[model samples]
Target: MATSTASYTQNQSILDALSRCIAACEMCADACLHEENVKMMVPCIRLDRDCADICRLTAAFIARGSDHAKHVLKECIEICRKCADECGKHEHEHCQQCAAACRACVEACQQYAGQA
Candidate 1:
């Protein structure tokens, strides 16, 4: 049975991964907005937005221990991969941080996103 939000507590690994990914997305978005050539960061900006939203959704799914958690984690993995790839192309501190976070999330998802 699925757990309710009030009773939910993600396993340490899952919670840590989600938190890192969430922070990465937010940092990436803020970085893109602060780019000296903001126009050049358009793609990264869009990806950052998507990454942030998906991470949040994934976290919620895990927190509730819902059946959809695996599905959401799978999606989060794909989004993190994409975001990490994009962030790796940039030379900014935030982009670097984002890349690390995305990688961490990918590893986390692999452990928990089973049989989905």
Candidate 2:
């Protein structure tokens, strides 16, 4: 059975989406680490991990309504964008899915992060 997410205040959908994206990215990174051509995916996996961590933190910050969420979200967007771009270079299915997730999260983070 799938676990359901509880309701959160302010930007709940975006936060939930980001959390999912982060998890997918993390899983993809781990899978890439175990691939035969791990060396070729090292950098992409590294950034994927980094982006996942940042997205997780950003989601928590937003959920908690922290004052620093904006700053963190700004950084998270940058990381997500970079990671997505890197992941797109790979031909693996995991990488492709992770790239899509990261892009969605990036857009959400940027929208809620601060002024346009």
Candidate 3:
């Protein structure tokens, strides 16, 4: 049987945050690749990709009302924090924006986790 998400009404905010974070991370990663010092941005780019993927998965888990949503959210929070830290080290506009998005995602994940 298909899972119902009717009980997950509070997840809407988390979903929105995840979506924004994914976009920001993707954009940051692509911008990093085009930077003159691509080598220096490898860590940031990698973290951005990781953050985006984790957020995507977390969103899916929440949307499906999966039993493992909280577990996935824990990992998502960790990755988002790491990505934010890494991105915050850079002076690039994209990096700064990505950091902000990651931070927002972390907050949303934490809030959802608390309610779970």
TM-score of every candidate relative to the true structure: 0.85, 0.86, 0.93
Tell me the deviation in Å of residue 17 in model 1.
1.2
Worst 10 residues of 1 by lDDT: 1-10
lDDT of 1: 0.82
List where candidate 3 sits over 4 angstroms from the true fold: 1-8
User: By TM-score, highest first, what's the ranking?
Assistant: 3, 2, 1
Residue lDDT tens for model 3, 1-116: 13235344577888999999999999999999999999999999999999999999999999887999888999999999999999999999999999999999999888888877
Per-residue C-alpha lDDT of model 1 across residues 2-95, encoded as one tens digit per residue: 6533233336567778788888888789878977899999988888889889988988877766888877778889999999999989999899
Tens-digit lDDT string for candidate 2 (1-116): 12223334337877877887888898898889889989999898889889988988987887777899888888898998899899899889999999999999887776665431
Give the Cα error of residue 4 in candidate 2, in Å. 21
In model 1, state the lDDT of residue 30: 86
TM-score of 2: 0.86
What is the alpha-carbon lDDT for the whole of candidate 2?
0.83
On lDDT, the leading prediction is 3
Candidate 3, lDDT over the whole model: 0.93
* Model 2: worst 10 consecutive residues (lDDT sum): 1-10
